[model samples]
Target: MSRKKEVAGSPQRAVRGPAFGYIRVSTQSQGQTGISLEAQRGAIETFSQAMGYDLIEVLDDVASGMGPESFCSRRGLRSALEAANSNNAVVIVLAWDRLTRYSKFENQLRKIAFDPNRVVCIEEVELRQNGSKAAIHKYNEVMGQRISSGTKAALDRLRSNGVVLGNPSMKTSVQPLGAQAYSRKSTDLVRQIADMLMESDDPFSVPSSTVVIKLKERGIRTMQSKEWTASRLREPLKKARRLIEEREAPEPPPTFGMF
Candidate 1:
């Protein structure tokens, strides 16, 4: 299929209304496998053409499908949903699980139903504004649970076989110095700086010079064995503050059926 130029303004409409594609893959490796982003895009685009709808845009999210937060936190999915709501268009995916695999799928179903737009999962189900056929939605929910379970089992098998998952080691030459590279001494010093700043009335107003002095007094040197300059000290302190904030952030509200 020919790639059309993405327009800057409102999406061009068709006889059947605009169609927005939403695609996702859990990991970079999944993005390269058979059920890749490209495969999903092709399916959505082809389906849109066959159904007489103008394909407006394709949004992608590289995130796991295990939880509602995974879907909620995806910027791409948010944009797609907003566009769909604005245009009263249909959102297409390769399967229902691509949207979410939450144990209680009805919560997400209800959310999509709030708007007049439809959600079309090519392989498993189609949810319309009027609502999904109860039996069909239930079947899709069961299938999603099975898929999540199987994926977890496979990951467990890989772990048992000593195959490490997640991102590879950062190359120092290509990337900034990561926390892993810092010695315990430097890490503690950075944390001390972060804590002091956090305690201040205005964290941003806490000058970098104060951090430098603290590092010098603590006899801490960077991974490169250089004296702590304001610029050199910023990244570690930033990382430390981020870690603290993440630890202090409130947990997400529980999904439906948690009670």
Candidate 2:
């Protein structure tokens, strides 16, 4: 009878509800600079506010991937996930990298679908342009390639210049760019080029000459239709904002070397 009662009772499980958000920054600098914990919270709050999600808890971890194990693998993160699973709470996050920077592990998380949607990685995946499904995928792929190649080239150039890169302790020495080094117009052009390049998935990957010709045939400009040239399309990115117009916020100034 006891055994039967045990079988009949089973384990009573209470339905869970969405209640927590999880955020993480890989390195101390990333936590402080590029992807600050505060920035993560702000972004999450903005997203939640717009989407109407009841965010009741936040789990923030400041851990770097020194090896294979991720910050998500920590006990605190594990406990948070368990609680969310039991409560069926949606775990809101700012970007997939914030939760798990490693692509492979992030993929694993995607595979293990949790009830109440375990995580929400905002700004991690680029949305396809409104159009045919096939076209959107193709466009995104191309853009991603261009951006990646451009970034790689920029990093390589920096390395060649012998500038110290990375955190202070583990940094390699290199020269630093000085103030008043670049002209305003030049800076603007650099910025435009960088924007175009960053938006592109591969710096080397671009529409073929024929495609460019066709676009020109259709009266479309190759970035600068006023004076179209292959060189124009391949220039480095830089910014040209007026010094006076630049925001003078003292609290959170953008610093270099975060990358």
lDDT for position 93 in model 2: 64
Model 1 clash pairs?
none
lDDT of 1 by residue, 1-259 (tens): 2134243553344557787888888887876552456656656665565455677888888878887677577777778888888887887777778887788655664676534237776664343322223323443555566578779999999999999897665454424454445566666766776776677786666678987887788787786788989899879878777767776789877785687
Worst 10 residues of 2 by lDDT: 1-10
What are the Cα lDDT values of the candidates?
Answer: 0.68, 0.50
Off by over 4 Å in 2: 1-17, 32-35, 65-68, 71-76, 103-117, 124-259
Q: Compared with the true structure, what per-residue lDDT tens digits does model 2 show for residues 1-259? A: 0000011333333424355666666666765543355555555544544444555666667676433476356544555576677777777665555565455664554554554245665553454122123332443455466568778999999999998777774323322332234454456554544444344455334454533454356464533336445555343311212221243324554765566
Model 1 TM-score, all chains together: 0.41
Best by TM-score: 1
What value does the lDDT take at residue 198 in candidate 1? Answer: 78
